[model samples]
Target: MLVLVFGYLFGGAMTVPGGGDYREFLLPGMFAMTMLFGLESTVLAVTADTARGVTDRFRSLPIASSAVLGGRAVADVIDSTLRLVVVLLCGLVVGWRWHDGLGAAAAAVALLLLLRFAFIWVGVYLGLLLKTPESAAMVQILVWPVGFLSNAFVAPETMPAPLALIAEWNPMSATAAAARERFGNPGWGEQSWAAQHAVAMAVGWPVLLSAVFIPLSLRRYRHLSR
Candidate 1:
């Protein structure tokens, strides 16, 4: 919520030729950014369990091995959804209206949940791979760069040409773009192949990430238990 508020304040500060309402333009990105931040909780919880040997205890239990990870994933998604709702309500209080009707808003929420689901798998993989809270803590620093490099806070065109190219292709950029378009934010770049591809990539990424990581993480868990 602080991040979203700060982003609105920062957006309000910028001077541009075709100036737009910063609050309106920024709210969708803030929504996406909030979900991006939620991955930290997943990482922390998983790493903590590993560090305390709670995961090992689960491994030795009579329950199916998948239950341990599956339960965590289910719980994380519920928690993330609640957080998104609270942040959206905060956006509403700050003059961020949803110009796009109910359908678009619903789709936007679905996309956010999809992103969270994908990141859960990432958290699982990281938790299983690192096996120690300190190791995971060191690697988790990359989330900031990944979050900042995309269109979450500013227009990708505002970045240097080389960096702009990379930001343009970033997955979070696609998610932000799609959310902005759905939310009716102004000053978005010209609709190009990138914009068109963003929708597909945004949806496809979570599915692909989950497919690859869930099995890999489960396999790793099984091996560690033996």
Candidate 2:
């Protein structure tokens, strides 16, 4: 909420390169950003559980280890969905509307949630690895760079060639660009392969991230018992 207000306050001067309303461009990116922000809370929750011995207690139970992580993932999904809803309503209040059909809008929402789902494992891994609130708080330092380095607030065209290339290829950029395309909003205005294939990248990035992190998380969890 605070972030959305802050965006609205300063988003006026942010001109889209191809000439479109900044709000339209800002909202879809905001949706993706909202999912990214959930990482902090997920980390905090897991670290808190570990710090308080709650995770150990869970491990002692007859439940499978996967169930323990799965439960956290489910809880985070609900939380992410609620956050998305609030932001969506807030976007509507600010006069941002999806110009695409309902089906496309639904796909956009699915992609946003999928992004969140993939990040859940990341948070779980970090939270378990960190195992303390102090360490988990460092995720905050990581979050801003990951969030802002993408094409969320402004287009990649507004950035230098090198920075623009990075922004264009950011996972968040894929999701943001895909969401914008799905919602029929303005995009980063790049003819590059990444920009043009946003949807595929959007799906692939999360899958790839999950593939890498899920194993790391499971391995980290196993080591926790050592």
Candidate 3:
């Protein structure tokens, strides 16, 4: 939570002229960042347990094998919810408001939670695949570049042509664009397609990612115990 709060504050400070009222732009990105951070930590913890032979002990117990991974995912979701509350409170303190009213705000939060759920499954798959703390730590380094390359801190158009193209297609960019519209931010572009497509892509990616990773993680978990 501190990282996200300070991250938004620092990001807001860097973007002059908009810094005073940039929460509309910064809030969604911070939410995404918080989710990603939580996902990475959950993955790391699970991988560490596997590496330390804790998972072996759990496998020997009479408790259902699914309980191990399921419990971690559930606990991570609860933790993510708490982190989101903190981030939202900080946003309120910094003058963030949802102009599209409670419904839209709730939808935005729901989408964020969905994204976190998707990532949790992805983390589970990765944790089981690598089965080591070192490999999981190495995988986490990719998060920085992925987060930065998206429209988290700047408009995609402001980026160079090639990079802008990549940013536009990024799920984070789509999520942020949808969030900006929900917040009633001005100058969100005249074309409706960008926003429409962004909303679709943002929601779709998480669904697809979850569908793919969750089963894979479950299979890998079963295999590991055999």
TM-score of each candidate structure, all chains considered together: 0.89, 0.94, 0.84
lDDT for model 1, on a 0 to 1 scale? 0.77
Give stretches of model 1 more than 4 Å off: 7-19
- lDDT (0 to 1) per candidate: 0.77, 0.89, 0.74
Q: After superposition, how far is residue 193 of candidate 2 from its true place, in Å?
A: 0.9
lDDT of 3 by residue, 1-226 (tens): 5645665567455442333345566677777777766767877878988999988888888877668888988988998999888888888776667788888888878777877888888888888878888888776676777788887676767779898778777766677666666656432352335545776877988899888988898788878966
Better of 1 and 2 by lDDT: 2
Ordering by lDDT: 2, 1, 3
Q: Can you tell me which runs of candidate 2 are displaced by over 4 Å?
A: 6-14
Off by over 4 Å in 3: 1-20, 62-65, 186-194
State each candidate's clash count.
0, 0, 0
Candidates 1 and 3 compared: the better one by lDDT is 1
Please give the range of 10 consecutive residues that has the lowest summed lDDT in model 1: 11-20
Best by lDDT: 2
- Spell out the clash pairs found in candidate 3: none
Write the residue-wise lDDT of candidate 2 on 1-226 in tens digits.
Answer: 7767865786666768777778788899989999998999999999999989998898788987888888999999999999899899999887778987999999999999999999999999999988998888799898898899898887787788888888989999999999999999887688889999999999999999999988888778767977
